[model samples]
Target: MAQRGGPAPFPDNPFQDPAAVQPRPGPELDAYNPFESSAPPYQVPSAAPPPLPAAGMPPPQAAAQPPRKASPTEPRNYGSYGTQVPGREKAARPPQGGPRRRREPQGLAFPPQASAAAATAELLKRQEELNRKAEELDRRERELQNAALGGTATRLNNWPPLPSFCPVKPCFYQDIPVEIPADFQKTVSTMYYLWMASTIALFLNFLSSLAWFCVEPSSGSGFGLSILWALLYTPCSFVCWYRPMYKAFRSDSSFNFFVFFFVFFAQNVMYVLQAIGIPNWGFSGWILSLIALRKNTAVAVMMILVSLCFTAVAVLGIIMLKRIHSLYRRTGASFQKAQEEFAAGVFSNQAVRTAAANAAAGAATNAFRAP
Candidate 1:
């Protein structure tokens, strides 16, 4: 019997014999059989007689039965649980998210959609309003500019503002407010002329750079960059120096005066660098003009003009820097006041306080919600 294959695995299944296991039927097994007869209704054993109504009262009639529901095979629908009955309408439901009505402003009806002609008229009216606003803004701005220049609209109403020395018509710098002292006006005005001279020099250099691109194709990209730089730098240079200087004079602020002096000092250094005509500087255009001096007659003429302008800027920049230094000396700037201004600007800023308050309120709200 134990000859091979671990005694033949005990006959592969010892329980295959019918008598080895018997499945006893539970009470529910009979209930699941569809063909089985239905069981008799449950009956209770009577222990005593039921109570009777009083002798004087009549016996009660049987209660009426409710109608039967339709069978699953029937096609008729009784409707869902909340559906209205045949004889009566259902009441409307209140809106789920509470009150749905919006109050109109002042009980006025909304404006009607405009016809084509009405739309055109409305557009014209709006444009007129905008034009009026624009004119008011321009008048107010001009008045402010005049006030800053130490003149009044009333005084200048009879005559135009002071004329500028620039050759261009409608010179924008002519109306700009400069609040410098009468003694400093000549130097300041010359400084402005220097800015114009610098712009002219840059334009001349821009032209020369285009010329140089033909001579040396390697630097062709510099031509466009130079043109762009000249266009952008001219207006920016005026604002950067002139506005700061004006503020310094107008407020006589020690902090502002120091700022102007420091900034313009750096600017003077830049002027010297530009006058040197360094190759591949952002002002490479000026450098090319110098290189083309001997080869091209027209370029030589342009170079000579730009060279004179650059020299003038360098000389005038040095003079203006010195004048600004002298003005700073007279401004009564003190170290203590500068420190006070810095402290106040940092600590008393309204935006910083508002942000801090909002952060604290958010933290408090989160804390209240945590538990």
Candidate 2:
């Protein structure tokens, strides 16, 4: 009989019986288990043994090798690469894109924990050999300032390196051997001599430029500018970079160090530009000399000589710049200390205070007048 509206009409097999089919998997015959990774290696049965040793024919029996007993091994498993096995001691390897190791750090400043005793000690100990400065902090700066001025040391002006018969008096007293420390005297003296050479180079530049003017009337502008440059650069270079360097080394003044480094870098850059010799710039550079050589040989000779001097000056400037930078890194000069020194100096100066007062008052008055 067919049932309606229940599941659906089903055909039943006459030979099949639900009661006879046993579903239990006990210790008798095992079912196929795909997850049994611990299963032993599959072994194929041996072929029926070589027909009983071939009926005793003096056979190749002497060449037969003794069979080796195979070591028991669990079956190889798939889907387990880059993962920890049951007995592994090492961790899983990192991915191919992992961060590289043993990379060196560059220019990471690990500032000392004990750089300053107090905020006021910023300039003193933040520089070189700070461990010794723990004692005598108060009297040190006063003595330095006094020594800088002629209050403590009787430093007479002996600059210009001229004789008594000459009318032009010696300007500033510069005794590098006497004043500068033993460690730094050589460097400072070298710089002083370099400066003198630079002065000579500038003068030659002016003379060669004058000769250029005499040869070609069109170059009168360059000659005029050259004279101006010589006069301006000579004294200004001395005052700007050289004096600042002198003061920095003499008093261990960080502010002066900052000034020296800044001005001297620009000074070296100017040396390079002068050596390049752009037209109408009043320098005996390569371009100007080569151009003059085609017109007048005598004047070109002078210009070429001056250009060589400028080149030498530029090269020396680069060497000295590197040397100075190395000293700056190794000595008691830091940007933080320089800032502190500058702040301390500004606050102490009476003129700066007066200027500040005037500026503030003017600002206030202007603001009051604004609608």
Candidate 3:
């Protein structure tokens, strides 16, 4: 071989061993060898390894490597991967257009309808409870009512009886004390009857006058005078006698009775004037008397007669009422005296009666002992 332009070649030695043909220790020995040196030592290029396997596939050019051991902090993923447990597989879903499946709750579940039914049942139960309470209350009320209506004989017997206080004083009636005197009723009746009779008589008298007027219109102021008389008598009768008599009979007041008598008498005078056809007198009577007479001729006349009769009745009624009132006044005073005596702790008739009964009982006991 031809030598290259470089350091001189070493001499071949027959005595040297083949292994000993290596370079000796020197700076020249540390120099780079041509066969070993393709490039600068500091600047050599390295060949890259083959690409990794695609997901779910084997590597294209290299044999698969043993999987690296997982660090404690690293999670292991396995399946196509090696030597590691696989993550939970997602449940495989059916493709679209497949029949839908119902999903059930993993835990206890209540349907809306079931919940509503439960609420409704609870409400019904509550209503039933309330109804039961109401029924119990009603039963109690009825029981109380029955008790009050004398469920026990003793209770019935002990209850206070109703008081009777009618002026009629019917037989078999309970006697409740009244403010009016006992005689008031009788007096009022008597006076009322008398006044009634008087009123009838007065009415007849007025009618007679009307008849007289019909027979001789010229003798009086004609229909006008008759009408006037009717007007006067009618209202006067009511004002003087009827109304007052009613009051007297109803109330038995002496003052009312007195007033009734006074007004009735005055009315009588007016009626008399109307009957006689006294021009100025009848007019004045009509004007002065507080009679509410109607304007119609026939009605007025009738009313007048009726009023007159009522007036007479009222007068009699007044008298009776006065008597009644007087009796009542005396009775009231006596009652007041009795009340005062009772309040003062004085022995009343009732107390005396009681004392007498007690004394008689004592005496009887003494007599029996002596025997």
CA lDDT of each prediction against the hidden true structure: 0.67, 0.80, 0.51
1-371, model 3: which lDDT tens digit per residue?
65788655554674575557765688876785645634333435469865676799955655685644544445656553343357754556798998998998787788899999999999999999999999977755664566567563322221123345633332221111121235444553454456446545544545544544554454354334545645565545555665555554444444455566677557555544543333323231232222323334553455455445545444555455466446546634344453454455435467777998899999999999995
lDDT, candidate 2, 108-190, per-residue tens: 74546544445547665576456556445644556556677767544457787888899899778776745577788888887
lDDT of 2: 0.80
Query: Which one is best on TM-score?
Result: 2
Q: List CA RMSD, all candidates.
A: 34.5, 24.6, 32.4
- Order candidates by TM-score, high to low: 2, 1, 3
Error of 3 at 119 (Å): 76
How does residue 270 of candidate 3 score in lDDT? 52
Pairs of residues clashing in candidate 2: 128-332, 158-173
Clashing pairs in 1: none
| Residue 321, candidate 1: alpha-carbon lDDT | 81
The CA lDDT at 40 in model 1 is: 42
Q: Between 1 and 3, whose TM-score is larger?
A: 1
